[model samples]
Target chain A: MIHVQGLRKEFGPNTVLDGINLDVAPGEVVAVVGPSGTGKSTLLRCLNYLEAPTAGTIEIDGLALTAGQETRKQIYAMRQKSTMIFQNFCLFQNKNVLENITLAMEVVQHIPKERAVDQAREILRQIGLLDKQDSYPSTLSGGQQQRVAIGRAMALHTKVMLFDEPTSALDPCLVGEVLSVIQQISQEHNTTMLIVTHEMQFAHDIANRILFLEGGSIVESGAPDEFFYSPKTERAKQFLQYYSMKRYQ
Target chain B: MNFDLSYAIRQFPTILSYTGMTLRIAIVAMVFSVLFSLIITIVRYYRIPVLTPVVNLYIDLFRGTPLLVQLFFIYYGLAQLFPIFVNLSGYAATVIGMTLNTSSYMTEDMRGALESVPRGQVEAGLSVGMTDLQVMRHVILPQAARVAMPVMGNEFISLVKNSSMAFTLGVREIMAEASLLGTSSSNYFECYLDAFIVYFVLSKIITILQNAVERYLNRRGGAVR
Candidate 1:
């Protein structure tokens, strides 16, 4: 389980996340949807201390961290419980696909090289990237690179996986492949996931719950059906109307 | 007084004799300079408190001054100022001067390469739970080295050629030997031309080796762009 209380992130005087609170049950898939600059990415990044929360308390699998008061030990402990998949498929450009997956396992987790390679190979096979094990990320397409990124996160077996607009950088033709991989991972693993995405239809399909965030606050939160079909707030309805209009066009 | 091709050709053996010494100074200076550059780059990268400004000033002072002046200062001026420096060998002083000058430039090259690696890469490494040091060693530096290879190669070639300046300190390297042979034989043009050929060939060899290393790195799937 993951619990966040009063999560607030401020970049100087501008606050990105304002007193946001949410809880995610283990194995739950929650999609954070909002317009750009609404703090969707900031919210996810804060959970893992990637963008340190200005004020908040995050409790993940028994490790608790208070904002402005995290020690190195606590930060690392929190980081170990969560891993992130970036929008741009931030694969280490210098490493091949196989080395990318094994790097953290060998260096951070202290797994033996042979065992790490075996684990990486298994994940690659799972993501259908076995053939690209030796290929550099630059050579791989965006979709394939994101799958490799997914495989990298999975290898860590974190309690929570954060996706920051995973499909945002992919071409229209390539988006489906990466989305399917994330969908499959969400179904198979008991890892709790917080995905910030603009792929409305995919979010509706995969997310057990939906969070409608606006102006650094959750405007509405409910099951997908309720959140999509009968939004409680006018802002969410307006946001959905724009999304539907854009999708139809 | 006619130009004598045979005399120039004959000067090859004498010039070649000192090739080893010239190469020795350049290689030794290159090794130490590169090491020192890495230290400076890393210190600057982290902006280590008081030491950061000191390193900046060091780079500026070394880079701002001419190499010849630096060599003279270390070889002659320093000897006058300190008794220990009076015993410093000409070879040592020359190497020290070259290393100090080259390392300042190398530091800037390395720092640029390190910065060229996108910030996203560092974020990705951290997101996966790798420590800051691990990310630097495993992800950042490898990629930075790839980007900085050609520049570093250029620095090395410059170092090799700049070592000719060591002749002023009487290190007896290629240029020094050529000067001696030219003055003694009164055939300045031929001996100097021979020295030029040696320097050119050495530089060409360094370039070839550099390209070969780049090819090898590229073959190993170096990052694109």
Candidate 2:
């Protein structure tokens, strides 16, 4: 489970996230959608403490971090419970696909190398890139690289996996491959996920709920179908209009 | 223009005898330079409190001044300024001077290399729960080391050439021995030519070894299997 309250993030004088409150249940997959520069990615990053919130309380699994009282141990413990995936698919360029997946397991989780390799191999097989396990990420196509990234995230087995534009950086032809992998993983129904994405159709198909954000807060949120088919707020309606028009073209 | 071809050929064996001395200076300095650069770069990379500014000043001090002046300060000047430094040996002063001077340049190279590893890799490492130290070890260093190799090779070659500065401090390395032979035979052209040949060939050998290392790291870290 993930719970956050009054999350505020600032970079210099710019307030990116403003008084955000959120809750995600175990096994729930939430998709956050918004116009550009609306803090969708910042919100996801705040959950994992990738960008420290200027002020907030974040609780994931049993780990907790609150403003003014957070310790390094608490923050890292929270991080171990929740991990973020990036749009860039930043696989360790020095490590092969299998090592990329297995690295955190060995280093952070302190699993033995042999056990981590076995688990990483299982994840690589699941992502349909078992044949390319020894290949470095730079040698793989963008689509294949993202699969390994997801596999890397899976290997950690964190309770909450946050994705920042997982498919936004992918080629149009390769987007489906990654979306399908996410879709398949979402069905396993153990890891809760918060994904910020521009793929409305994929969100509609994969997410249990849709959150439409504007002005640094959730302006409208509902079941994906309801939010897609019947947006309540003007900002959300305009967002859908803009994205859907681009989709049809 | 009064070159002595036969005399120069005879001096080759004498200068080549000191190849080990030149290499000992370069290799020892290279080892110490690498260690100091790693420490200084990591300290600055993380922006550790108090130490970063101190390291920055130290780098500027070594990098801004001449190595010859630095060797003088340690070997000759420091003895006059401080009673404790009176017993410092010439060989020790040369090694210390080279290590300090070389690492400043190397720390700059290492900083660029470390920065070249994309910010995304750091985020990926942290997102997976690796601590900052773990990220530096497993993610940043390997990639940065690859980026740092070529420049580090150049620094090592430069150190080999700069080791000649030790001759003025009464240490009998390549240039010191060459000067002695030149004085004894009055055949300065011949003896100096031998020193030039030795330096050139040693640099070539280092280039070959550096290329081999680059190939191995490139093969292991990048491209197809």
The best candidate by lDDT is: 1
* Local distance difference test values of all predictions, in order: 0.92, 0.89
* DockQ agreement of candidate 1 with the native complex: 0.73
The sequence of per-residue lDDT tens digits that candidate 1 reaches over residues A1-249 is 889999999999898999999999999999999999999999888887788899989998888899989998788778889999999999999999999999999888999999999999999989999999999999989999999999999999998999999999999999999999998998888889999999999989999999999999998999998988899899999999998899922
Q: Which candidate tops DockQ?
A: 1
Error of 2 at A29 (Å): 0.8
Encode model 2's per-residue lDDT on A1-249: one tens digit a residue. 988899999899998989899888899999999988999999988888888899989888877789768888877887888878799899999999989998899888889999999999888888899999899898999999999999999988777888899998888999999999998888974789899999888888889999888879889889987998888888888888898789922
All candidates: interface RMSD: 1.3, 3.0
Which regions in candidate 1 have their CA more than 4 angstroms from the true location? none
State in Å the error of residue B163, model 1.
0.5
Query: Residue B215 of model 1: what lDDT?
Result: 94
> lDDT of model 2 at residue A11?
91
Which 10 consecutive positions of candidate 1 chain B have the poorest summed lDDT? B216-225
Window of ten residues with lowest summed lDDT in model 2 chain A: A240-249
lDDT of 2 at B174: 93
Q: What share of the true interface contacts does candidate 1 keep?
A: 0.79
